[model samples]
Target: MSSAVATVPGAEHAGVSLLRGDGVITSYTPSSSTVSEVDRLQSTYREGPCVTALWDQHTVVVDDLVAEADRWPRFAPEAAARGILSMLSFQLFTRDDSLGALNLYSSVRKRFDLDSQMLGGLFASQAALVLAGAQESVRLHRALATRDVIGQAKGILIERFGVDAETAFTMLVHSSQNTNLKLVDVARWLVQGRDRPVSS
Candidate 1:
């Protein structure tokens, strides 16, 4: 974590935290107590930037807590509880799609400098690499599911169109290409009659 902050280059009095996959308060710099408290609140209430970051796998910022509206009502109270006036948080994401976050806070209202925010973002990037390992495990587990679904859809195509697996896959690919959609979308539609494949 110190190494990550050190590599950040421009942050002053930087505070960083690494969230657990479950959005728990895993660890952070001691000066980042508000962030730690917010993490605890998020874990306890299932709300705030930590939980939001995990869910959305993106950055979250509260520039000015006092002037800000009800963007995060529950988190607002939690911020008040922790004496936090401003914060910036980002999800530490893996390529395979699991999430965690790095949170930073300041006692002064809207006190964050742009460099600190970027530093926080950099922190998230490092944690994202760690998450990639977990995410790959998840991806491996889902490979079978993906293959099964595609395979089922391919079988449906073969039966319906009297084509071989290669031809069926080709047709699926052709349709996807023609309509600017993914092969999975075409396969999903083929498997389920009268259905449109919707992205999750």
Candidate 2:
């Protein structure tokens, strides 16, 4: 089913980026350092297909770069300066979770249309499968970090409340559950005032 969805040739020219837990695009499939530079420039300016894909959670097409000055003046100039003249981007997302964007860049205007958009959507769906796997990886990493934070918070709670480690963790978990928040969030809040520095 996913293969049928990804029949388009995005993997040939497209650059697929997977977002890290810190909300930065940590990796891309095409392995082009140029794409990351382009993405960084677009993100810095807050325009172009990259930002549009992340914001709208859908495909973004710049069918004409030289012709479309009124649309994105800031972005087009930078793209033109970098010898990029056209761009198409698709977000990898499910109903609630956004993974990242698959970006396609060209050196000419009017290189894509509605047909390309349909094809790009198909490519994005396929990209979402890989992104879902990346999400599982992120979940595992986050779980480990949360466990560490909980351990530190537990030490504080045990000392403050005169409770055992189990009781302290149960308290933190219960509070998180009751507040509809992640355990990491609760632990962070509890440890925010601590002298210990955070990695991020």
Candidate 3:
């Protein structure tokens, strides 16, 4: 965010917005409290340059929020009241499913120019890659942890019930279905000794 403010002319503050897998929007690395407030407004209103860039276009440059009041009826007035007049937002992802947006804010009308847009776009691309990689790492780590727990659960079932590996797995699946719990949850329960006998 500091780099964005330094590199992008007329950008007084910067923040990153992320759309989580659960469909919630979150803010990260806000340059200041004012930037955080702006991001919160965007999330609450669901209508702003950052939201528009994330959902519709690759880039959204608002030279003056007052002039674009009709575009974002609820968000524009609120943001302007906070002393933000111009904004430049770039979609972080280039793919069909967007990750989020990188937003730059300014207090002066028509603050951002063509040069600012170009620089911000480049920064957004790099930020997108970093965010994607981090997300993938977290997913992989969770998958590995789940696999290990399930394996331990299967071992316990095999030893206790004198069943083969496949049979133990089937028993776990049956218990998951009977209880309407997730397979992972069933396995975790057995591993933790919360449940002894498999339903099947």
TM-score of each: 0.49, 0.62, 0.92
Q: For model 1, state the Cα shift of residue 13 in Å.
A: 8.0
Sort all candidates by TM-score, best to worst: 3, 2, 1
Q: On residues 1-200, what C-alpha lDDT tens digit does candidate 1 reach at each position? A: 44544554432233444455444555455344544566666666666665666577487776676654466666667676567777677766533323456666656665556776777676677766765666578778878767787898888777876789988777777787888977776666666785654221
lDDT of 3 by residue, 1-200 (tens): 89999989999999999876655668888999998898889888889998899889989999999887899999999999999999999988744343678999999999988999889888888888888888778779999999998899899989998999999899989999999999999999988887556876
Give every collision pair in model 3: none
Q: Write the per-residue lDDT of candidate 2 for residues 171-198, one digit (tens) a residue.
A: 8888788778787787888887655322
Q: State the local distance difference test value for candidate 1.
A: 0.62
C-alpha RMSD by candidate, in order: 10.0, 7.0, 1.8
RMSD of 2: 7.0
Model 2 ranges with Cα > 4 A deviation? 1-13, 17-27, 94-99, 113-115, 148-164, 167-200
Model 1 clash pairs?
A: none
User: Which candidate model has the greater TM-score, 1 or 2?
Assistant: 2
The most accurate candidate by TM-score is 3
TM-score of 2: 0.62
lDDT of 3 at 152: 94
Q: 20, model 1: CA deviation in Å? A: 6.3
Q: How many pairs in model 2 have backbone atoms within 3 A of each other, for residues 3 or more apart or on separate chains, i.e. clashes?
A: 0
Quote the lDDT for 43 in model 2: 58
